[model samples]
Target: MPIRMVDDPQDPQESNNDGGGGGGNSNFPGGGGGGGLFNLLPLLLGLFRGKGIIFLLIIGAGAYFLFGRGGGGCNMGNLSDLGGLARGGFLDPKQFERANIYEPLADDNTKNPIPEKANLMAYAPAVGNQGEQGSCVAWSSAYAARTILEASRSGQQGEATKFSPAFLYNQIGLDGCQGSYILRAMEYMTKQGSVPYDKFPYTDRDCSRQPDQSLIRDAGAFKMRGFNRLSLGDRNDAIDLRAIKENLAQGAPVVIGMMVGPSFMQGMMGQEVWQPQAGDDQMSGFGGHAMCVVGYDDSKFGGAFLIMNSWGPEWGRNGFGWVRYNHFKYFVREAYGLEPMPKTGAAATAAFTCEVGLVQVTQQGNKMVAGSYAPLRSISNNVFETVSPLAIGSRFKMEVKNSTECYIYVFGKETDGTSYTLFPYPNANDATKTKYSPFCGITGTRVFPHDKSMTPDSIGTRDVMAVVVSREPIDWYETNRKISSNPASDYASRVNAAFAGKQVSNVRFQSTGKGTMQFTTAPSQNQVVAAIVEITKR
Candidate 1:
């Protein structure tokens, strides 16, 4: 594992994720590289140029995030003060990291006499200590930065608002050892949201900790609207700083990964401010370490970025320090920022959600009967259910009846992890097939797989179907092609995004085609309900 973390000085064995190194937990499609992958313009014009070949190419390899590739990073000698610095391999699980590099705004401010700067420290949570573990990615993202965003949005502060890095790190890191990727952490937060610190504290490093229903609910309460990566492509330092400052100016914290070596380890300790020193580049690197830029100072250290460290108050000034621009330009590996979703007026967006069910088919004497309901246990908050749609000829459908004008979507995930839109079936005419419908403009139930009963493609194939509704008009073909990178996670993340934090409840199901797939699908705290049915080979 290429892990870069500040080693816990007291515990020499467990290196702090403060230094990038090996270790992680969650599975990755290595997709989420950047928005570049989903360039709407060209993609809209020439979608699936080779049919499914392009998507498969994207899913198979990544120009970035394909870790375990490079080896032998900066060398950090045996350091007793901080835990062992990982030798650098896969530091952040998000190594499949893709930065959304922002272009310089039209009113470029880099030319201003006073350098561009912003301090988001007010919105940030208290500095945390990761102790002797390689969880800096978690501490930086979930524990600190995400907590800041959530607390600011909800106006609920103190310990209750803080998200648990342990909840993220243990699950995202390798086994329970140490190390993780920032991208994986973001995916978890976006798809499942983050639980409060109290629910799963950092002291417990059990990466295998399974969350119960309540924890799952709490985790789903809030999610990032989305994230943007910082790109400094062909830009001068001043312009690059402006883009970063712009995000911080919005009061959103920036998560950063930087190189830490012998000089970094030695110089960072008890230092008022840190700048790259002579021979610092020559020394072996302990590993890449992750941190959060709460603010920046144009006047400090030749225009420095104010950093939040998880090494605790003992390091830096009360768990904070300034890293100069030169250091950032040379050492920093990646940076990503996330925005918060609205707390209200959510209903105005997309309040509609779909209910799904398995249709039991049997021959009743002389007549063939289709559409008998199967049992699905209704969970309180989230839509969680399992059905065994065994054998061939198994039927399924999704019902959406709504007062709101919403668009419905159905997706099918194959055994190989690739997925495609199932409902609003694509037609031959490109112009007419502009969008799929069963548009929820009028009152009445609309069933997906409506044209014909949805039957299992093959018994050996376990097909999973999800019914979803979005108020925003999503180009289904475009979105489907975009999410094909890692359908297992990305597809669900897209649906969760459509749900828009609605609390889902009372999802109903009628086994027969008469009652069909259904749900009240109301947003409980803005959650739109949707569930997946696994077609089994019984």
Candidate 2:
């Protein structure tokens, strides 16, 4: 998961497969080419989850507020659809544990001359509506941004079918019409991926129905390679306009989170450019929404970022409108760009099966998983369900072989709620070297306990595990000491914080394997991959 300079899956340099995306393709009804213009919205995190009989009542009432109240052409959105919009754009660092912040280097401006005006609208899918649901996060990132990237990158002619916003929104939110965070949606797209609209479709209420095995596998094709922040805060919490334009100039559409007042929400349809009039500030009632930036023009209304809305094509100019730079600085809170995953199918790990269990062995030679390990595979999906469990007090060693060799930090919450690091136990003799597990190399499978086999303390003992494989070198003394001190504390966050601002790939699954797991360094110095599993009691 190396960070690419441009909008590329790998090798930032231009390739033959970049495709001709100017075809103005679309799959959503009335959605097609942007006609040289586009628009945006914020997130939905705290909206009420209309449920049971109450949900039907709310939907009925909401329809009136959204449609009936606005008696004319193009309703920007109503209080029913615009409430609680600004809830997902990175309010706290601890809030999104796995989210990364990517700042563009000034060298970009020096090396790449940006166009005064740029438009990715031609590459964008037709406008999509989030309805009354607080799922703008999914619509913008999963359905819109991801759709734009896939359709543009695939070299496919004609319009491209949309990836399901519901596939992401339903899975991430708590329930009903409650919205989700862009961070979660982006992470899901990068790792698990989203199913096509034909598979899951869109829903304004209820979050039931998920991907099946077949759909899950197919989702791999639409997975995003990764995502990076376009602009965060410079001065006065406003994002850098230059960086936003730089990315768009490269044909990369940016997904943004912004605040919207009544002026924009209640009366934005006819405005040439979206700049709030009097009393347009984001007061408590003003909603925060998510949208896509498909184009920008320096000359239009004195510089603007053309936004693509999820309010359907009836709003603005075909659901797209320009926002002045100053207006954007005042309201725009977050902006991000996505990279496409190579169409070479899913990750290599997804193509194979693994078994991670501990065997009561009395020897030590294979420092790695002995048999199934392949030379080419670097990372794997999940090992297995339950490593054949061991009897109480049995001496055992983990028998395993991973295609990729890397250091493993075994930390997990025991069934009783105790937190502990399983792999690198405190080495009293030498704090530098782990007491139980150390040395992540593939010359030969090493000993499970380094010198002796591990024995369980009790018969009914069980602990769920989070196996973290990092490419960054660790200060063993500090990591082990810090994690060991808080066995029952939130040490997992500490382990996670170590990889902040770095690319992280999370693939959690259950584990059933060799007796004792070991540790090693990853093959490359990029991306921290972590997997979670439950330990079955034997």
Candidate 3:
């Protein structure tokens, strides 16, 4: 058996056609040599013969066990729902892993040339409500991001645009009925951007399976340089109140996750200006309650923050009110701010050699399952330029500044356009843990005696991308996969190279990122830092 690097089935960036080549054991119930429905007779008969329960479940759940072997079909909604309320603007605790990857940069004050004390909300449009759905995160985040775009345009907020939370919720594969994480929601907005509310509009039903691209293809969507997590003492601790004020003073509202409890609910319902004191209730209710911090007033209501709640204009002083600073801190859990970027034809193109700050990677088994880029801490760090190509024996190095629980996987592509998984190759196999989940093994910062380097067998210019994820051994599962008898017509045939005898047996090392040092799998609180370098012979 051999392993293959295949393009993600769900991803659209790669071609869907699985090319016609390779041979192996039948990728289906019977030898992949018979005609259509008749070939399934044996499998169907076996289901009735003492395996009815398991057979029913496989058909019922419709889980894609065959990997990229399925045909394009209608995407029914709710089957894949995670029950997380597409919470518009939450910060995932997992993101803290790469928080310290870049050095801190100064804030840009030129965007807000107004006096130090001013409220951008004065120009903001009236707020809307989340209705019965747990979509406050989407509504609040859209409101804040929309207001920033509006202000930068007309220098006022009165005619503020309303972006669609429903569009974001459904398009990003979030379950609006169930509460969602704000940070995850914001990530979608930052990457794909959002459309106007009226275009797609919010609905109370299960999220739509597909987004209407017609509504999303315009230049109206506002894309930020990126979002920022504003913390107080330590990133793991409470958010710094001063930082919140500074961001608000810039006329851009900050998104904060407030703890929703009885007292706070009562305050919003009763008083025009709500201020619930700490310890009003000992019981914790629903968490991930987020709202926009529009502005702060040191003189008004004894030093409080002006908040824009997405409970409709009919609630809380016409959908907006104030929270005393002391009470605000007691309930607020996470804070984030979006730095506005100039509206370009599209997002800035990636430089040949870019130092993308705060790279986050999610680990699944031994593979780096997912990766995303965050804004650089400083504008001066945008040192992405191309130089003379590197030849063979060009040494590469990666240094970790703030170590966290993760293992690094460095991959390279050479001038000849050949790809290689430099580290965590065939050498990193664990034979004993055949059934353990991805996290049930050694996990921590890899303590390498020295920097790891690689040399190319062929000479040419090259570039590299390094991904760090939780330390775990890669696992492969064997199962029946449906395949077309006519391989030329099968799309899965292109990416099913794993089924062929594509074996590589050079065990240079014995573990991927798995090490003897064990660490907690819980979300990291502190930041992690690391860098990738490529040295070419001059």
The lDDT per prediction is: 0.54, 0.52, 0.42
Please list the Cα RMSD from the true structure of every candidate, rounded to 1 decimal place.
21.1, 20.0, 21.4
| Models ranked on lDDT | 1, 2, 3
Of candidates 3 and 2, the better by TM-score = 2
Task: List model 2 lDDT by residue over 24-79, tens digit each.
Answer: 12122233322111111111212434354466456545543333312221112332
Residues 248-326, model 3: lDDT tens digits:
5555567777755444554566356764443332212223466888777666655677788876665578777877665
lDDT by residue for model 1 (1-538), tens: 0001111112222111111111111111232223233334355435555657666556534422321123232212122235533322134323432423332222212211223567767666778877666777788888888987877766776345788888777767754444666677777787788888878876633556667778778787766655555544321121244446656765667787666655555566778787555434432233667788888776665567888888777677877898766556555666766653543565554344444455454434532234555555433333334444355545544444544445566666655565666666655466225223333332234445432345555435445556665554466666556545654564456555544445244544343334344444434343344555544444
After superposing candidate 1, which stretches have Cα over 4 Å from the reference? 1-104, 110-115, 156-160, 233-240, 346-473, 476-538
> Would you give me the overall lDDT of model 1?
0.54
Question: Which candidate gets the maximum TM-score versus the true structure?
Answer: 1
Clashes of 1: 54
Off by over 4 Å in 2: 1-98, 107-110, 232-236, 282-284, 343-538
Model 2 scores worst on lDDT over the 10 consecutive residues at: 1-10
